[model samples]
Target chain A: MKDRGLPARISCGPEGSNMQYGFVTIYWRDMIRFVRFKTLLISSLLQPALWLAFFGIAMASNFDAMMAGMPVPAGIHSVGYLTFMAAGIIAMTTLFTSLFGGIVILFDKNWGLMREILASPVGRNHIIVGIALSGVTKSFIQALIIMGFGVLIGAAFFAGYAPLQIVIGILGILAFVALFALGFLFLSAAIAISMESPEGLQGVMTLLTMPIFFASNALYPIDSFPEILRVISLYNPMTMLINGIRYFAIGPDFYALGHHYAFTQMDIALSFLGLVVFSVIMFVLAWWRFRKAVVT
Target chain B: MVQPGPAGDDPIILVENLEHTYGNFKAVDGISFAVKRGEIFSFLGPNGAGKSTAINILITLLTIQKGRAVVAGYDVATEPQRVRESIGIVFQDITLDRDMTVWEQLEFHGRLYDMPVKDRRDRIEELLKLVQLEAKRNELTKRLSGGMKRRLEIARGLMTRPTVLFLDEPTIGLDPQTRMRMWEYIKGVNREGTTIFLTTHYMDEADQLSDRISIIDHGKIIISGTSGELKNTLGRDLIHLETDNNEKAITLLEHLPSVREITVRDTLIVLMVNEDGTRVLPGIIDTLRDAGIEISSINLKKPSMDDVFVFYTGKDIRDEGQGPARPHFLRAGGK
Candidate 1:
């Protein structure tokens, strides 16, 4: 054979820090998939808007008529039912989008595509971080769409705020959305990696979404919930996220559905902290699952 | 013949007593071998022969159950990152994402290996040209034909210019012409000084492509040598004789010193001769004639890889009963 000399050596240093940004690669590939499936992309973006249009309008009209004669306490901003549940819609959209985002991992695993990444030099944590970032990005886009649509459809968000406060409110809402999205995406990834089939993952997700979506304050007020459910909602990450969204979107105190809604600064901070702790715990769970994952 | 690299005879991959088990079933049972730095080496085996299991361990996909393995000068168990960085892989099945374009697939691989932007772009261009997929760069992977997908996978495997490229059944499910063309691409890659570790069940693939062949069966290496050396172990020539009385012919030729071994397949008696067939044919004909056995057909030829494989493994590829052979081993402890 001809002397072709040695193969070209890789350019990375011995420390392999150049590969440290490998999560960016994973994120890029995922985004490509996210956009490439035009049907999936458009449907995911449109689903939340549809929920606001049909479900939000339908429920708001009935609930508003029922609460029209309720006495509003002095010095309290009395908003319509649409305004109340709009924040819930944003929370709901973020929840659903982020929870299903990691289904890509299950699909990749089943199709043998994950073997390429699993055998690469990229750390396992990078895979989790990458999926989490992309899931968060998807949630951000969906949340923004729902916010814009909700406002156009007469949900009284940013009703009396200055431009500066509005910007801060939007940022605060996104902060909560990011944390909540990260938490569910990490949980989804953990389950997806451990599952052997997509059907199993779909079943688990269905089982999870039932309690997570309904047991919290997304659809209506959770104050009337039974004692057991009230305790569960108190600690629910979904409730924590909605609390933050409402505190930022609406005023600190408001009246809706004949119920007085008040959020203290300490309450908002604690809600944010709840999401932080949830996402951290989910991240650790995902990291442990990825470390134990063996794909061949 | 591939010449030794500047590293002299230092092996690029070294494994000692490598064993892997799935629960109580042993997939790879105490196999040991080494691959040189700049040669194509093959593990020639049948289905369920622990080929994929061993490749997965070497690629660091599966945890090392026992023994030690070092790939590209890095311990697979301890320094898997270094090992991963130093090698590339083309899996047995088509692992390409159906939705990804050809360009994106290669680009993704380059990024996975942390290749610089400029280098990734330039290499993508070069590999697209090399694999003749430049025209299909923007086409989705699912749109490409089977051969094109395999070629694209090969290009992706070379994205980082890995020191050792591991291919498991690279040309599986391809047409005859495509299989030949795939072999050419593999040889061209090897000629560029990247040591290739290939596992294939195709006898011709191992014979024509690999610099060394190791016949593995039941999770063990039966033999290892160059193609010529392997074929020579079955003797120089093979003679096929169909006599009117096959039992009498076998008795007559069994005592001939030239005949090394004899096996019967239905009515044909196949003789493996140490001496050249041309000289041994006359003595065999006379012996059969003296035994009052009429010869219906007689043929003489040198041993092919098929003969060598069947001789060593004792399993006929054309037989339908080969499927049960593996499960039978699982029941009997694979002794």
Candidate 2:
């Protein structure tokens, strides 16, 4: 029989440490990775900028009826379809930015980078938190940048609660980031490991990305869709997110929960609660699977 | 009669009845081994040998199927979190976030171990110097070469100053120059009194670095001993000669009392012998010549890990890949 009772438990120096600082370490690396990859920055400006310049203008003439059908809330007016489109565009930008960030986690898995983190002394939950925090950070910056572009294009809202709005925006970004990152992190880690192939990556992306982006309130309002399509859109978590962000950004419009000049704090709170629950579930499931992946 | 080492010193690591299976295939069979603290223990096996699986279990990367593993007094399965908290692992593939610079990557790992901010800074700096990549601290890991990236990984593993450092095929793909440097780094880490448990298929590597090595085959520990002791246990030195007529050569060589084991094939005669090979070389050649056998070529090569593997399993380690074996998880849960 061989004895593998390896002696030496790792010493930071001459003294033994009794603390938990892995979260900070993991978070720092994750943030750096997200920035260095440059995925969000390029997509952030390019996609939304294109939508504002081309989609909002070229199709502006045809979208009149589409805008007319949306019930404009009190004290808010859509002089053109582009005005109605801006909120959805902004929300879509956050949705896309947040959702696509999920795939990058899969990319990391394929490259064996995740194994490095898994093998570390870092707690599994901290690893999830670090990645989620980075994802949330990227989603917020991208959403804010898209909002700036919208403002440049004459998109106006009831400019009163800037602090509350910023807080709401952050809360929305966190909600979206937590849900998308956790779900996708679990998915990507699962796929890369089980398949261990990049060939079917695009198929997987389309399978997940298409349904969320199209079926949700990204391109059109949920009310404008057919009966069956409306049901699908209304049920989607992305629907809750896109609608919530829009109401907060422009305040009570056809998109608002009520036909009044007001924003619902309860809606934002609901999305937060929903996403937090999802984030916890997904995070726990992914961590458990990963902890068993390459080590044993 | 065989005598074992005195058990006066408690083992640094002890694995009892370790086994891992994926479906019907047994990647790591019932294997057991112990590593002493401050010792460089190498798990030597070829391509499909359960080396990686074994190391993974030790490091807590792969879950142990049916066994007991204790590292620095921490149980691997029950206290996996604590096992991970204490162990440092340098995986075979690139594990550092390639998007970040060397400093950022190391800093992140230091924090993962929960090292203090001030302590993390000192650890990262010390690690950079230890891996000889302090100058490239600011450079992105994506821009580094294979060797530099490997060194960076080793440095990252040490960021935690783990009690037992696990390395999985650490130098498999590196160039010769890089492999030598990596070997030195491994030696240097071992010298720091950090116990290292590594897996590799390279026999020369096992001979050069390991204070002791365990030979694993098909998930089983066939033999475990130091480099010299294992080779000595073979009882004779193997002299594999490629000649024109293997049959006639073996027939003549079989008479020599010095020859303990002999394997003959088409144009090769592998003779495991003791004493001087040259003392009987003259007779071997004369007997072949008198027997009208054509001597086109004759080359003698020594037995090594490969020979040792074949001697036990009746198959070469190089052939492990071609068969249906493939890569199997050799040990328990991950690092």
* Predicted complex 1: CAPRI docking category: acceptable
lDDT of 2 by residue, B1-335 (tens): 11234568667688999998879989889888888878888888876677788778877777777989898888887666677777788887777666778888887676656677899999888888888898999998889999999988888777777888888888988998999999999999989989999988777788788988888778898888887777666544555566666777678778877777776533456666675666655666777788787777554444465566556655555656553322111111101
Model 1 agreement with the true structure over B1-335: per-residue lDDT tens digits: 22333555678999889999999999999999989988999999888889999999999888888999999999888777788888989999888899999999999998888888999999999999999999999999999999999999999999999999999999889999999999999999999999999999988899999999899888999898889989888799888888899887887789999999987765668888999999999998988888788999888888777777676776654452363332111111111
Q: How close is candidate 2 to the true structure, as a TM-score?
A: 0.82
Predicted candidate 2 versus true structure: per-residue lDDT over A16-67, tens digit per residue: 3343445466556666655565765576567877887789866665766555
Predict model 1's lDDT versus the native: 0.86
| Residue B211 error, candidate 1, Å | 1.1
Q: Write candidate 1's Cα lDDT for A39-106 as tens digits.
A: 99999999989989999999999998988777789989998888888888888888888888889899
TM-score of the second chain in candidate 1? 0.92
| Highest DockQ against the true fold, candidate | 1
List the candidate 2 regions with Cα displacement exceeding 4 Å: A1-24, A37-42, A59-80, A159-199, A217-219, A253-296, B1-7, B236-256, B280-306, B319-335
List all candidate RMSDs to the true structure.
5.8, 6.8
The 0-to-1 C-alpha lDDT of every candidate, in the order given, reads 0.86, 0.67
The number of the candidate with the highest TM-score is: 1
